[model samples]
Target: MKKIIITVVVILIFAIIAIYCKFILGLASQMANPKVSTLEKEMSWEKEHKLWGDYDDYEKEDYIVKGLNDYDLHVTLVKNPIPSDKYVIISHGFKSNRYGAVKYVDSYIDLGFNCIIYDMRDHGENAKATVSLGQFESEDLYKLIEDTYNRYGNIKLGLHGESMGAATSLMLLAKKPKVDFVVADCGFDNLYDLIHTSYSVAKVGFVLPSVNTAMKLRYGYDMKKTSPKDALVGNEVPVCFIHGEADTFILPENSQVNKAATEGYSELHLVPNAAHAQSREVLGKAEYRGIIGDFLNNIDFK
Candidate 1:
């Protein structure tokens, strides 16, 4: 029995080591070679759906923002014709671009808010294809907010981000609490939980340490730093978290976690019979718009 116990312990140690090595290799592979699929490429169903829009009338323009590595990051901006002091920065999710959020631009514009929609790194017109989730993308948001303030001059800023973008917005608040308000839709509370969800969706066993290790190696950031839970805690900014009750991608609990993290000031709206980013589609535009309008009316942007 003693020998059997010793063997079991030895096997567990070896398994753990093997998993760590696999994650490290995965991270190295991602960093050594970043790959972005072509905007025209339809690699998967999700990719195809994400690319199914034309922003011809959106009138896209480019802006170069200075980055930490002296990289003049390029951002595509879509401006509303009717401008106002209130402005919103919309961030798209993983494997998606500005077009994905264009549908909601009018909602903000109708409220007399000018919208600035931009593509994240390794996405859209950006010259890379590696997604660090919100690990590095959060910096993009910070830079954009700063640029907006410089150009527009101390305007009331609002944020709308979906999935990975939502996570990025939360991380941005943790790093810098400048935005007046935030709307996070279907954002995962924890990076570690997100990785586990991905694995579960693929019918794989949970390897929490492996996912955490991979994130650390790829982004040079730990899970704690990337956690929306930590970011939302004690945040002064009022956040409205919108999640579909039927969402399986990030799960509604993730939004609840964010709400709990932010005290009672943060609001969570769970749309019934909706599924991930489909709240508007499921509830119809009028109802969806009304919900957001009510939230905005309740908040004091001053």
Candidate 2:
């Protein structure tokens, strides 16, 4: 009986160890080469459900922009005929490219704002497939902002980002804090929570902590360094946080926490029955446009 008990204990220990190792390895692999398959899935769902709204006709210019650490980034410049002094930079979520946010181009363009959309380092037309989330991608956005300013001569700037892109935009604001206004939609407050939630949803238990440890080991910064909550705290920039009430991926509370963290002008809009980026879909095109238009109009874009 004693021998059997010892054997059972040993088996349990081995099982735990195996699970930990597997989780760490999986996370490391994903961190080294973040896949955009999830983004593609969401996009396919949106298209099948006819979620995206009609976009205004605009000329699209494809160009290669310089990224951080000598990496080249790809971007699509959507220009409006009016050519107003205001510019809006839109960033897509994880595993998504500029096209994912194309539905928003027309609204901003209609308001006489030049819209610039770009692919992150690993996703879209970008050459690399590795993503450190927003750790490194934030630098690419900063460069794009600088390029925009240099060319357009310090025009009023607005940033619109969803999910990972939203996190990246918040980090940019923390690092620079110069944007006239920001709209963060369905973004996670902390990277740790996001990783844990994602793994849980995938039925991969015990992977979150292991992956987080490996991330810290591989890169100097942990999830806290990439936290939008930390970035938004005490920030004086005008920010609008739009969240879906039924969002399970990142949870609506994440947006609430981030909204609370902002010390300056901030507003939160919880879409009643929406899920993740489904606010626009649930609210319909006209209502969605009106909400965003009202938010933009309320901000002093000087």
Candidate 3:
């Protein structure tokens, strides 16, 4: 009887250890190697250059900024045809590069705002190996915002991001960078919640709890503490959130909840038949341009 009890206890301990190891490995792989879908590859601007004629006509200056942990981030500063102090920092989504932000540049430029599009760590030319999701990326954004202020001096700033980029922008609110407004497109509310929803009940039972712990142990960042929901709550900045009603990847509900958390200062726009980051295209050129233009016009920039 004693031997049987000891054997059962040992088996349970080994099972727990095995579960922890598997969870940690899976979480690490997800963060390190984000897979880009075939549809997303086809969505690149290089493949659709004709859609944005004269995109090459604009002059872009290459800039480098240092992140919180000394990670060097590459940036392309796209000055408007006519110089203006009004600027917008464009952040692209997960598993994407600065080109992912190219589509939105025209709208801001049309509004007479200069654009700063940067590659988040691990996604573009940056040397970082691990994706912090939005943890360190948010800090990188804050640094870029600060660098913009220090370089340009007293400029009206706005932030715009898509998907993970949007979540990073939302997280940036906690840093309290001096800015005019924010535009978040198809952003998730919380990192853990997003991951949790993406997995099955069986996976979540073991994997969800160790995700943050593994992140902290291996990557040295706490995943649970970083979220757009935490940043947007009671945030005084006027924010405009756009999401595709047809999006199931992150779901449009994330935006709805985030908009609700903004306490009446934010505007939410839902585009029909669009799936994640396809709002501008699905809304058609004229309507999309009008909606963005109106939002920018309403902001009382300094």
Candidate 4:
């Protein structure tokens, strides 16, 4: 009987270690090497949808900045010739590059706001290859905002982000940067909750808590600290939350909770029948552009 009990204990210990290594450490590595969409596929989609109409014809500049822990970030500046003091820094989603901002670029340009689109670390042209979810990504945003302020000098600034980028934008709010408005599209509320929901369908929910603990101990990433819902609480910055009603990946309720947590200072726009970041594409250019334009115009930013 004693031998049987000892054998069971050994098996449980081994299982714990296996779960930690496989789900925790392995998951982090997988996130760092997400499958990126090819240029051909991106161009085909753009052509079919007429997204970013004539974006190639615009004048652009290449900008680079150093992020936290010496990580390098690659950025593209889309110039607006209207000579306005308004500017926007747009951050793309997980596993996506600055090219993902194609749908929103033309509208911002038409609205006379010069746009800056950049790649997050571990994705696109950025030299570094690591995913902190949003812990370090927020630091990258700080550097970008600071550089933009230095270059433009006290201009009206807007911060916009999608998915993981949206989380980073919200996380940055904890520091209260000098920006007129924020647009977070399809952002998750809590990193840990998001991970749990993503893996629950795969029957991996039992291992996720252990995985998060392992990530904290081994990788120094406290997943619980990366909550956008918590960040939005009492945040005075004018925020516009855009999400799809059919979004199961991150869920529409997360945005609803975030908007509610903002103490009635934020606006929530749910696009019917849209999924993930497909609000713009699904709503067609006119309606989507109108929503964004109205939000920007109401902000009273020049």
Candidate 5:
């Protein structure tokens, strides 16, 4: 009777562990596989925020750059009519496409910069694939940067990214790419904490560790290792970190943390009452543009 009871308890313990692991894997899968918005949804937001000019009217040059594993990255170059060698590559947030990054075009152009806005993998025109959160994203953008130099030839380059893109921009510092400056807006410091904060799970101590294991098993990347804060170690790239003060999602503290970690000239701006990726929308174009301009001036980024 005692032996039978002990066997049943062991079996129940194994069953509970299996159930918990299954749940953790589900969360990891959901986190990596996000539901991307349609082009129409992306364009509508672009149309709303891009109040000055019609995006369709720009001198647009499109291309398909090769990203990690030779994935096709849908890219577009919006040329400034003023004839300048300056360029700014803009990376949009998760679930958003190149069109979603249109709001920043006019501001960059006004600052005498040609804009290159591209769709990140699994978002926009690119074919569906596993999102690395920001692990391979930094490498993918590095590929685009290399291609940009090959195509444009001797151009003054800069980077501007929002949310995931912001994290991507900062993470690329690990490669030590030759870019003039980086403007990171509302980016997370790392994926693990981001998932925890986003889901607001109560038993995170029990939940996150299993999810980390699942992330490695399923996605070929570790959530704990894929961190912007770690990526900033010894990176000397001039970065302007912008975040919304009221952003409970990514939290304003992320920018503060990254600012402290960055080895280069770094600045943080927390927009009052702005939530998540709404810093530019809340600050207005002029104020937002001024911040970038001021950063460039402070860095002497000519």
Candidate 6:
């Protein structure tokens, strides 16, 4: 009887270990390398979701920018007819392509800023690579900012980002890019807490630390350090934080925390009845445009 009990306990211990190993590996791979939506699908998604913008109507040119690790980033230059020195670089969300930024183009153009948009790494037409949430992504955005400065020669610049792009923009602030302002929409404050919440919502929160460990081993970035809020500690650049009041995916508190974290001039606007990445849609074009225009004007983001 004693031997049988010992055998049973050993089997149970091995089974638990095996299950834990599998879960950690799967989670590390899944989060670090999610399947993204195709560019064509994202355009159709924007239309189906009633997002308004005509990418073809703009006079734009395409080119490439080398990012961190010499990774090539596909970029677009959409010009305003007036030809001004003010520029805004718009970054789309994770799983979305550069075209997803079209919805905001009209607003920027209306505000008299030329629009620059691009496909983030591992999204759209870019080559496949591990997603480090905001670590490498922030570096990539900084590269784009530098390239813009080199090409334009003394221009006022602003950054506009959605979801992951928002996080990227905020994270890059730690590097102190030379820019006028940042408009972040529906971004997460921390990758660790975000993913932990995801796991908790699925009833597996306890596994996150192990998974994070696996992530560091499999991919070379630490998940716990990917906090956009933490990045703003010493930043002085003006940031406009926008979020949907009803955003449950990332929650509006992400923007709230960001506004609180920034030592610089900041504004937090919550769009009523909007979900994740749906602030502009819910606020309508005029209201959405107004929020950004007012923020820029307030900061004299010329």
List lDDT for all candidates, in order: 0.73, 0.78, 0.81, 0.83, 0.88, 0.90
lDDT of 6 by residue, 137-227 (tens): 9999999999999999989999999999999999999999898999999999999999888889999999888888888888988888999
Residues 179-255, model 1: lDDT tens digits: 88899988999876676677677765355566556656665766656788887766878889899999988899999
lDDT string, candidate 5, 1-302, tens digits: 99999999999999999998888878887768888888888777666666434467779999999999899999999999889999999999988888889888878887899999999989998998888768888889999999999999999999999999999898899889989899999999987888777666454555787788888888888887778999999989899999999998888999998899999999999899999888888887889899999999999977
By lDDT, the best candidate is: 6
- After superposition, candidate 4 runs with Cα above 4 Å error: 1-20, 38-44
Q: What value does the lDDT take at residue 47 in candidate 4?
A: 72
Off by over 4 Å in 6: 1-12
**Model 3 CA deviation exceeding 4 Å by range:** 1-20, 32-46, 49-53, 201-206
lDDT of 1 at 148: 85
TM-score of each: 0.80, 0.85, 0.87, 0.90, 0.92, 0.95
Q: Between candidates 2 and 5, which one is better according to TM-score?
A: 5
Best by TM-score: 6
RMSD of each: 5.2, 3.6, 3.3, 2.7, 2.2, 1.8
TM-score of candidate 3 to 2 decimals? 0.87
How many residue pairs collide in each prediction? 2, 0, 0, 0, 0, 0
146-165 in candidate 3: lDDT tens per residue? Answer: 89999999888899999999
Worst 10 residues of 3 by lDDT: 37-46
lDDT of 4: 0.83
Q: What is candidate 2's TM-score against the reference?
A: 0.85
